[model samples]
Target: MKKSLETQTQLVSLNETLINELSSLKQVIDESNKKMADKMDITANALITSNGSLAESLTKAIANELNSQNRKMFGQMQKIENLTVESMSKLSSRVASDQTLSKVAGNQQVLAKRMDGLATQNQEILKQMEIS
Candidate 1:
């Protein structure tokens, strides 16, 4: 009986040691899980911040490109407008000169008619003087 009691006590002590080891393992697993969760959170936050910065950079680049294109387009439009105005001015000047030329031609026709009339009168006068 004494030997049996001693064996039983030894078995009980072995079971207690096993229970303590299991508890210690459980605590270590919990701490590892917590550390993994913290790392994941930190990684998620970093990804979010990086994505936000990338989006901002893309937006600014697009806006700058649009502004540059707009400026170029505006300059082209102004050049076209200036060309149109210059062509119109030249056409107006040509039209005025054409009108002036027409007026001068009409005056020349009137002067020719008067000269022809005077030549006819001089011929008649010369015929009368020859007969006298």
Candidate 2:
């Protein structure tokens, strides 16, 4: 009966030791998980920072490209405007020349009619004189 009591005491002591070891292991596991969590947070923050910088750079690049295209379009528009003005000037000059030519042609027709009338009057005068 004394041996049985001693056995029970030893079993109780071993159970306490097992409990302490399990507690220690749980603390170690919790510490490891916390460290891992901190590392993941740091990595995520770095990625976010990198992404922000990349977005800014990409936006600047797109804006610059658009600005360059706009400048080119403006230049082309100016050129087209100048060309249109030149074409209009040339057309106006041509129209003035055509009008002057038309005026000269009308004057020539009037002169021809006057010459025909003078010839008819001279023929009539010649006929009268010859008969007399």
Candidate 3:
């Protein structure tokens, strides 16, 4: 019975030592995991910051390009408007000139008829004198 008690005491002491060792190993593992977690968090934050700045730069560049294109489009529209106005003016002048030419043609036809009547009357007068 005395030997049994001593064996039990030794077993208890050994168990205590094993618990202490396991606790030390657990602490080391936890510290290593915490360091890895901290580095990962730092990397993630840096990536986020870089992405945000890149997006801002891209937005500004796109806006400037749109503004430039709009200016060019507006200039093209102005040129088209000027050309339309010029074409309308030219068409109007041609129409007015055509109307004047029509009136002059009518006047020339009436003058020709009057000249034919005068010639016929002069021929009649000459024939009557010759007969007398």
Candidate 4:
């Protein structure tokens, strides 16, 4: 009879533990449900606040803005093209001048060699005169 009573006491303790765990689980579920409800309420309020339709005048205004932007971009593209053309012309002129300068430098080198040869011939003549 004492063993039977001890078994009963253990069963009661286990039942109480399960009940406490269930209560804790219920509290966690309730908090989750409250958070979901708050999020849904915020979504609903945002939907209600921004209910104004994108009507005809607003669409026309957006179209006008897009057109204005397109015109400005096209004008900028034309300016870039003009600048490229002008720069290319200047580069061509500079290249031509560089070629002419290179030719002039070659002629100067040839003239220097000729002057050195003449000076060497004059020195040989002077040495011969001094010996005679």
C-alpha lDDT (0 to 100) for residue 28 of candidate 1: 97
* Candidate 4 residue lDDT tens string, 19-114: 999999999999999999999999888876655443555788899999999999999999999999999998988898899889889988898898
For all candidates, the clash counts are 0, 0, 0, 0
* lDDT tens per residue, model 1, 1-132: 999999999999999999999999999999999999999999999999999999999999999999999999999999999999999999999899899899999998998898899888889999989999
Candidate 3's C-alpha runs over 4 A off are: 1-14, 117-132
Per-residue lDDT of model 2, residues 1-132, tens digit only: 999999999999999998999999999999999999999999999999999999999999999999999999999999999999999999999999999999999999999999999999999999999999
The C-alpha TM-scores of every prediction are: 0.72, 0.74, 0.66, 0.43
lDDT of 4 at 21: 93
Worst 10-residue lDDT window, candidate 4 = 48-57
lDDT of each residue in 7-70, candidate 3, tens digit only: 9999999988889999998999999999999999999999999999999999999999999999
lDDT (0 to 1) per candidate: 0.96, 0.97, 0.94, 0.89
**Top-scoring candidate (lDDT):** 2
Preferred candidate (lDDT higher): 2 or 3: 2
Name the regions of candidate 2 deviating beyond 4 angstroms: 1-7, 117-132
